[model samples]
Target: MNIDDILAAAESEAPDTRTVKVCVNPAVARKRAALLEALKQAKELDAKASTTEERLGAAPAPTTEHADRAQAELEAFDDEVLKSLITLKFTRLDGERWSNLTAANPMRVDVALDRNYGYNFDAVSKTAAMLTGVRLSDDGEELLTPEQWDRLFKRLSGHDFRLIIDAVWTLNEYAPSQHIEALVKGFGAA
Candidate 1:
């Protein structure tokens, strides 16, 4: 009803249940809004271009394609420069523990582990068990079965699987970042 009641209600909610709202400085907020609008416009234009090309069976303009490629190359270089790779070297026993965990679980724990990133440090590994779950299929309609997952896991080499294992472990320790998230899931999609 009043300011005091509103404050009380917010406090009463569980910390995890609380809805966080970040207020950027007004100038920064304006810039962010403009950037978002530009991103939307760019995406729409790309979609239109793709549709036109598909319908016409025509190639994209060479200059436009070349520019896009150049920009992508610059962005990739920037990403590489900004990111630092972390290699988690483990002894045989530790490696075995990691491999065993991966054999049993999918990377479903990413979302939960991410929640613990900035706040709860203690409940990481405990939550890692949650990774043993399902992923949406190519159609995003159904969950993959355990057998399906086992087959997929079997296809991975030791190095590929370990990359996943390290990525999962790092998620528990570090504050969230896109680079870290990419390590777990990869560049875009499978």
Candidate 2:
């Protein structure tokens, strides 16, 4: 029976005065069961729809741990600076043909470092120098100064291995001489 019929039957039953116990109609019971099943199915479908919508919605941003792990891996990735270092040949900038001299690529390294650890200019600068043997200059231009340039060639010299290799590489690409001079002159002494 339809809902209207069931409701009408229920309304009729409510007004009955001769109630020792009213006999339930089996057909009405069946209709009620069918209605319940339909309601259940509707509820299930609504739940499914809500779940799908949630999945489709913009995901919650990654946790700090997820971000940190990704950043650590990226900073540790050798390819970002390694490939560039391989192609870069020494140019006679200021009449110096140093093999380690190359322009800094700051994008990947900076992103990696900034994402993982809080920015430490000294640490980032040193890391870039170690990894790339060059770094972005202070003005965000090509490497030119003797201080950073020499830092890459000197401290990182003969030592191709370091924990912060990527940072060193970025430093090399940026301001190699300045880094070198800083190390040699001593921090704040220069």
The count of backbone overlaps in candidate 1 is: 0
Per-residue lDDT of candidate 2, residues 1-190 (tens digit): 9999998886675221110111123344344455556555655665566566668895443334433444454445434344323111122122121222322322345566544433443444443333333233334425435664454344332233232344333333335566577797886666
Assess candidate 1 and give its lDDT: 0.43
Cα error of candidate 2 at position 37, Å? 1.2
Worst 10 residues of 2 by lDDT: 15-24
Q: Write the per-residue lDDT of candidate 1 for residues 145-174, one digit (tens) a residue.
A: 557545545554555444444444554333
Candidate 2 wrongly placed segments (more than 4 Å): 1-21, 58-190
The runs of at least 3 residues in candidate 1 whose Cα sits more than 4 Å from the true structure, single-residue gaps closed, are 1-138, 176-190
